[model samples]
Target: MRVLLIGEYNRSHFFLKEGLQELGHEVTVIGLNDGFKKVAVDISLDQNYTSGIKKKIKVLLHKLFNIDLHSKSIKKQILKNQSQLKGYDIVQFINESSFLCTPKIECEIFDLIKSWNNKVFLLSCGTDYISIKYAYDKIPKYSLLTPYFEGKGSKNNYQAPLKYLQEDFKKLHKHIYKNIAGVIASDLDYHLPLKNHPKYLGLAPNPVKILPPNPIKEIKGKIIIFHGINLYNYYKKGNDIFEKALEILQKKHKNNISIITVKNIPYNEYIKSFDAAHILLDQVYSYDQGFNALEAMAKGKVVFTGAETEWLSLHNLKEDTVAINAIPDPQQIAKKLEWLILNPDKIIAISNKAQEHVIKNHNYIKSAHKYIDLWNSAN
Candidate 1:
């Protein structure tokens, strides 16, 4: 099989491509820089519009003429590479707005892909029309929108997600669904929203490249807690909640723990930034681990992320054994951290379990086989 993965989130498609290649399937990934994360792709779509006078011009044009210069550059890149993007047995989009373009432009890109590919599919791994609508209607008990509902973000900061609620995006959603083979969710957050839909494929857990186990050594003195932040997603990822929890924990146990916080770095650097960490504070609002959390867990770090009832039930695992379920409450997060600080042994045990769990369930090749089964079955 030949597969083309359009766009990426935390190098998700890159790893997926590697797994597929090992299984004797040809795969390619086309993706952007993902801003500061600088996620790699097989074919680069980055247009160097992120910084410098170009960015200022981009902003000015948008403000004055309703023109999106950056997006326009992206559209040009896509067209120039359209030939390289086609002729795949299967084509999968990483999101509804795979190109991060205006909705109308996405339709144009979709039409091009639709005409060229055998079976085009969608991946519900990020903010999209259906998922946003589902959360907007309060379908889940709590979601990334929890902060939004509590009125936390400014409109300009939320334009990416909030735009999914607009009519243009709705039409783009319909346009894709009307023609695509099916859609798959990378985790429970997206899976729940897509469940029972006619075009919905089952959830495929995010794949992680299992890391080599560290030699057994007892965690020393002050516990190291690593927190990485992406400013754009601060509110949605509940970074504010995590920050507040850190403040409380620091105030109470200043001498017991050390905190390292890095902001908006490249993907590789961000991963390396937390190497000494015994505990990784991942997102607060999620129903399953994001790519970062899973990778951290694979490295035998106890990760504070989504391991909720649905996730627990799906895996038939108990709470806090693999990863901590981080809710929206700062006080609750502080309490969880306090317990971990007190019980270093428990952290070690959970750390071991977390790595084992990811190896068994989320190994890239293991996940690739699952994707193969689903795609072939659909055919």
Candidate 2:
């Protein structure tokens, strides 16, 4: 089998491609840079697909209009590359969306390829417009109405308003769901909205290749906490709440513990940072696993997640071995950290349990084997 994976070659794609090749399948990765200028991994560039005057115009239109208009060009490219896709038994995709937030970008490509009668797998790596509506009950004005979202009207009011946005999102979901052959969740919570949808096929947590750091001598110092932030963007992954919590911890603890932000690290070095830290701060309010949290847990570091009771039940993680639940309150977070610092032995035991659990449940090689089985049975 030969598989072409579209999207950036991050930890997820790197691991998935390696696993597929190990199983005697040929895998070709065509990815754009995910901001890291120099990646240690060798990745191929599909300039014919992403570049050219037509695509440049479409990309500019996507930025301004929040719409995709390159389906005709992509359709031509697929027909040109039809032999590479048709000769292969399966073609797998990871993270189908372009950063411009248009569903039509990848949907058009899938439509072209699906017509060839070859097996296609779509890994819905993140939430789309419809999925966001089901989770948050509203789609931000900017996604649908770009001019209104960016201009003074966005600050004052919306022209089409909430009702119109809801209707538009629903229509998009109905159309795109019909084109996909399968939908794989990045986490258990990601699978729920599609469970009853006819396009639903299979699901798995985001996969990682590197195993957890081996047990090492505990660093002797104040407890170290890592919080990732991008000061430029203020949106839902809630960096503001994280900043507020840090402020409270600094004022109350007063030089007792060290807090660090691990942003802009090279992808390879990012994994090592977890092994050095005592605790990793996960997302705010979201109950599902993010890629960072899963990697941290695999390293045997204690993770503070928004693992509310509802989230736990939805994902079937009742008794968490590696991750600890943290409410949005800073006082609660500070108190939890204080308790862990005072009891070193308990932390060690939990860290060990986390390592064991990750290896058993989320190893990439093991997960990729399941993917192979799905492809074999797909046709």
Candidate 3:
């Protein structure tokens, strides 16, 4: 199969492409480098003018003259590569607005891709119209948008969800839904909301390129705990909760735990810096583990991330079996951290389980087969 995957999120498509290649399928990916994470792609469409003084100038031009130079450049890039995007057995979009282009341009790109290959699937891998709507209407208690709606989160935090609520985004969502063959959820966070949709397929676990467990070293003193923060989406990732919990844990176990917090670092440096850590604190606002948590798990780290009951049921795993389920409550998170710090033996057990879980459930090759099966069945 010749597959084309548009856009990237946390290296999801990169790993998926590796999986597909392993199964004797040809896959091409077109995406941005995804900020400092620098996700790999076959044909990169990353814009050079979206940072520093250039970004400020673009914003000023848009605000003063009502002109979007960024969108124009993105459209031009797409047009330049349109020929290479043709004639795929299947073309999957990473999200509804895959290329980060204007809605009209995205519609044009989707139409063109559909004309070339009718078998197109949309992967519900991140925030989207249906998921945000579901969060607003159904699961407002702890959804990413919940804090924003309740006036607890910054207005900037609501921008993406607000965009989804707009008519233009709604129209684009409808158009893509009507034309795509089906939609596949990458994990329980998306799956729970999309499971009942008319065009819903099934869950395909995020592909993680498993690595051998890093050898555990004897801890002489403080147990190192690492947390990487993306300032822009801090609240949505529940970093605020993690921050407060970390503070409490520090005060309580001042001599036993060494907490490290790094912000906005490059992907290579970020991974390398955390290699010697005993635990990793990942997102808390999700019901399922994301790519970061999975990557940490693959490295045999005891990741404090989403392992909610729904996720446990979906994967048929027991509570706290692999990764720890991080709740939104600071007190709960602190208690969990304190317990882990006190019981070093438990960390080793969970670390082993974490690697085993990734190998069994998120193996890239196995996930590729699932994707192939889904595409075939849809056809």
Index of the highest-lDDT prediction: 1
lDDT of 2 by residue, 100-183 (tens): 223454556556556664666667665454345445442321122233333423332432223324554455455555555566
Output the number of the TM-score-best candidate. Answer: 1
Which pairs of residues collide in candidate 1?
Answer: none
Q: Which residue runs of candidate 1 sit more than 4 Å off their true CA positions?
A: 63-65
lDDT of 1 by residue, 1-379 (tens): 8899998999788888889998999898998857678888889887665789988988898899989876778778888998888899999999999888888888888888778889898999899988888888998888878788898978766788889999989999999999888899999999998889999878887888777876225887899999999998999888999999999999999999999999888999999999999999999888899999999998889999999999999999999889999999999999999999999998999988988889999999999998887777674
C-alpha TM-score for every candidate: 0.96, 0.75, 0.96
Tally clashing residue pairs in candidate 2.
0
Total clashing pairs for each candidate: 0, 0, 0
Which of 1 and 3 is the better model by TM-score? 1
lDDT winner, 1 or 2: 1
Predicted structure 2: lDDT: 0.59
Error of 1 at 226 (Å): 0.7
- Estimate candidate 3's alpha-carbon lDDT, on a 0 to 1 scale: 0.85
Better of 1 and 3 by lDDT: 1
